[model samples]
Target chain A: MKYLLFLGCVIPYRISSYEISARKVLEKLSIELVEMPEFNCCGLPLDPVNHELMLTLATRNLCLAEQKGLDIMTLCPGCAGTLRKVNKALREDKKLKELVNGFMQEIDLEFRGGIVKVKHLVQVLAEDVGFKRMREAIQNPLTGLKVAEHNGCHVLRPAKYVGFDDPENPVILKKLIELTGALCLDYMYETECCGAPIIGVNDKIPLHLTGEKLRNVKAVGAQALITVCPFCHMMFDLNQPRIERVLSEKFGVPVLHYTQLLGLAMGFSPDELGLEQLRVKASKILNLN
Target chain B: MKNHDSTKPNSDGGQANDRKKEFGRTEHKIVLKASDLDPKFKYKISKIPGAERIMLCFQCGTCTADCPIAKFSETYRPRKLMRMTQLGMKDRVLSSDVIWLCAACFTCIDHCPQGVEIANVLRALRNLAAKEGLMPVVFKELVSNIRNTGYAYRIPELRLKRRAEKELPPLPKANLEDISKLFNLTHLSKTLEKEERQDA
Candidate 1:
């Protein structure tokens, strides 16, 4: 299956490993990913400040994917949520579609709305790749590793729009984790927000929230935390040291993008999946040490 | 105006002075004025996206109770904001720093029995706050970052060298012309321009 990969701003610049491992894993599964250089920010950052403008910007990206007659697949939950919401809004409301198209006229783009679907990578893996296929692709099963799943808010929130799984009780990510032969350890705050959305506004609150989740995961004895969104990965992975320092606790839980975990099980080395780039080392979990 | 005093005499016929002494406060009365309410504020908020249900809230504290941020910070309460918006206390709702504290997690919206989109209502309030130049400095910096570069955060040089070392493909540049045009067409540019002029 061919899809347009929308690498929203964060992955390309900050979290290249998510992109690298995702590309390699999808390639192994024979899913062709076409890169769209014209894609801009998914308009999430603008949502609170300017609702109409945010819709217009998200619609522009949707229109770009429509031109290719391919579905849009995103690595970030924020991008997936924004694009999915706008796509649903424009498709369901004619007046709103007209209003957004008016703004799109300036950019020489018009969204046909329903022509394309925006799928988060988690959705693509759970549904398109299928558990049977993923299991078959695993060359080295992770037998004893324990993982905590961090399903960030946007990917499964406002249940009506996202509709991927149960918002309160999501299991797609957990099931994907199990496919790699790792134990998806159940923990408190599994469905809580990573507080990434408000990180820019207030450092203290988001850090507290992230620290709380980290503490819970660490308490459960999970070797690592698995995530799908780049922003969540940032909070759990990049800021892990800072989070530990702030909370005065040592949580040696390595954070891995789902693709990275899947890549390891699929016979890809730690270096190949960019595990070395992570701040919290995955040596123990990956058996690298 | 009506004064509802909790320090008033109880059904046992105790004196107001006795109740005041019991409570140890002289200003325990809530003063409600008809003129203090902004009847148009609800309609104003309804105009914002995802906040059409602002008036549908029945003062149910589900949003507040389900809020993760509220669990930690006493000042951040979604249910109270909804009530303030409904009462047309525009200045109180928009000026308070609590409005900026919402994490936009949507847990409140997901669990709201009344189906009030609490998070989106907060977003609408934030937009109104920004228009009135009440946004925090960090949020303003993020807006400027997007306005100029089409991304929230700029990629640093060290990260650029690391990307090169990893042999990752070069990051794509944003179409700033279209981004700027959209910002200009919307009220964001005007609000930000006003903020800039005020700063200058």
Candidate 2:
């Protein structure tokens, strides 16, 4: 299957490994990941503040993807949720769609609500790649690593809206991890907040909440936490130290993108997955050399 | 607002007070102590040192409506959190796990009509929570892991060797000094000292 891969800001800039591993895994599964250039912010952060600007921004990205005649696959849950929401809402809201179209006219692009389908990489893998194929592709099973799944709020809550997984207890990520033969450790706070909302307003909340999520992962005796959202990855992987300094304590757990684990299981080396770019020391876990 | 005076006769009737006295006079006494406070005291955002524009909040639901996570989870209602912060009910706001759930989408800040910065308020509360030791235990462990490793994930040695094979940049090793510097930078250390003094 062919898909327009939107990396967004977090994955390419901070969570490069997520984008890399996702690409590697998709290629292995015989999925075509076409990179779309000149796509701006998903306008998600703008939506709550300015609906008009948000529509204009989101439609611009949709138009780019639509031009390629391919469905869009997003590794970041936030991107997937935001894109899917706007697309669906625009299709149903004619006035809003026209308003967005007007904005697009200035840029010489058109946004038709049904022009593209936006899906998370996990959804693509589960539905398109399939578990059986994933199992057959894995060279190293990640047998020893105990992983806890961190599905960001965007993927689940507002259950009727996102409609990807169970808001209370999402097992798709867990099932995908298990497919790699890694242990999916179930723990309290599995569905808890990672504090992504307070980032711009206050870095402290995300730090504190991310700290809490990491602690739960550690308490479960899991080796590390795996997530689908780059924002969640940033809060847990990039922002953990800020939280530690505030708390005056040490938590030994580490965070990873689900694709990073999948890439390793598929026998791809750390560098191939862009593991070096992480602020955290991810190399310490794998004996790739 | 009428100051809540428990010492005054119950507006409902003396029967309520008498019933409380029968159960235990202490209950009727409305025990007020420094320790009886909401353990997780949230600073009024307007009152937080250096955090401006908090007083502009008009209790509008624009922020709550605009939140990406709030649409998914009621636990992350930004408007409610803002209102709570303005009311000086720090304990209720600080103890809530909802504040920790925000994905920092910046959607709320963009949408808030009154210009009250909801996101910053959450940040301030989290910092205060850390100082008071009110932050969830899970959060404490995450901080510790990052302090020692520079990243939240615990990378196995095998992964490091593999990175070398792939020619990826080696992960940076964290040191005590770096972590200490970050700790001081957060200013949470000072908040801890201030909270301790308040307790004393």
Candidate 3:
């Protein structure tokens, strides 16, 4: 199956490893990724400041995907959530659609809202590439390697709109982790927000939240942590050392993008999956032969 | 407007004094005067999307309980904001630093039995506040980046050059004309203009 990949701002700007690894894994799974064109920031970053601008910008991207007639798959849950929420809103609300479309007229594009569907990477993998195929594709099961999953907030919260997995006890990512033959350990506050969105505004809180998750993951004897969203990955991996220093705790948990973990199971080397790009090194956990 | 004496509470009653004790400070003991409330602020916010269920909230602290930011932050309380909004505490709610602290994890929306999209309501409050030129500095920077580059942050030239060495595809170029027009149509351009003038 093929989908238009919406590589949202974060993945390109800071988290290229997620993009690189995901592309490799999806290619092996035979899922074609059509790169997005004329795409803006998915309108999520500025949603708080200007609601209409968010809608208009998301609508423009939706219209682009509608022209391609393929479902929009985003690596960033923020992009997937915003595009999906806006798509659903425009589909159900006529007056609101008209209001947003008025801005669309200036761009000379009108989106037939329901034509293009949106899904985050987790949803695409869990649904499109089923566990049966995934289990079969596992050349080297990561048995004995234990890791915890962080199901970034946007993927499952706001149960009314962007609903899929149980928001309270998310298991899709865990199940994905388990299929690689690695034991996915349970941890506290599994569904907690990474607090990445407000990093600049209040660095302390995100650090606390990230540090708490790392400690919890370490507490479970998990050697590493797995993430699906680049933002969450950044919080846990890129800022991990800083988080440890601030919290006065030392838990050297390597944060791997789910794609990187799956790529390892698919017989790809650490270098191929972009594991080397991680801030907190994964040298100890890359033991599957 | 300023009451220095916490012991000398005359009109609002002992509950106001008790409320002051909760904040742990004398100056933060703000009494809710009738003149300070708009009384129609809830209705105004109700007209905004995602905030349609604003009146359904019964001062439940579910939002604050489920909020991750609230766990570490002493001041950021979603339930208090919801109550304040319901009580028509417009100016105070808009000016609150806590409102900007919502990471929009949206756990509050899923957990709220009242079906109140608390995070969305907070965003609406922020959007209202932005109209009055009250967004945080980061938002100002983000607006500037999106206005100019169509990306939230300015991805450096070195990073763009590094993409090819890593065997990644070229990053999609943004349609600045359409983005700029949307910013203009949404009136975000004016907000940025106001923010820049203030900065200058």
lDDT score for candidate 2 against the true structure: 0.65
- For residues B17-84, could you state the per-residue lDDT of candidate 3 as single tens digits? 45567766664556567997899999999999889999999976888887888887766778888988
1 or 3, greater by DockQ: 3
lDDT of 1 by residue, A18-100 (tens): 98899889999999988786756887887777778788889888998899999999888888889998999899999999998
Q: Summarize candidate 3's per-residue lDDT along A167-220 as a digit string, tens digits.
A: 888888899999998999899987898999988677888999889888889998
* Candidate 2 Cα misplacement greater than 4 A, ranges: A287-289, B1-200
Q: Which structure is stronger by TM-score: 1 or 3?
A: 3
TM-score of chain B of 1: 0.82
User: Which prediction has more favorable lDDT, 2 or 3?
Assistant: 3
Superior candidate under lDDT, 1 versus 2: 1
Report the lDDT of model 2 for residue A102: 65
As a TM-score, model 1 comes out at 0.91
Off by over 4 Å in 1: B1-33
Q: Once model 3 is optimally superposed onto the true structure by TM-score, how far is the C-alpha of residue B77 displaced, in angstroms? A: 0.9
Arranged by lDDT with the best first, the candidates are 3, 1, 2
Query: Can you tell me the CAPRI class of model 2?
Result: incorrect
What DockQ, between 0 and 1, does each candidate earn? 0.31, 0.05, 0.51
Q: Which ten-residue region of model 2 chain A has the weakest summed lDDT?
A: A45-54
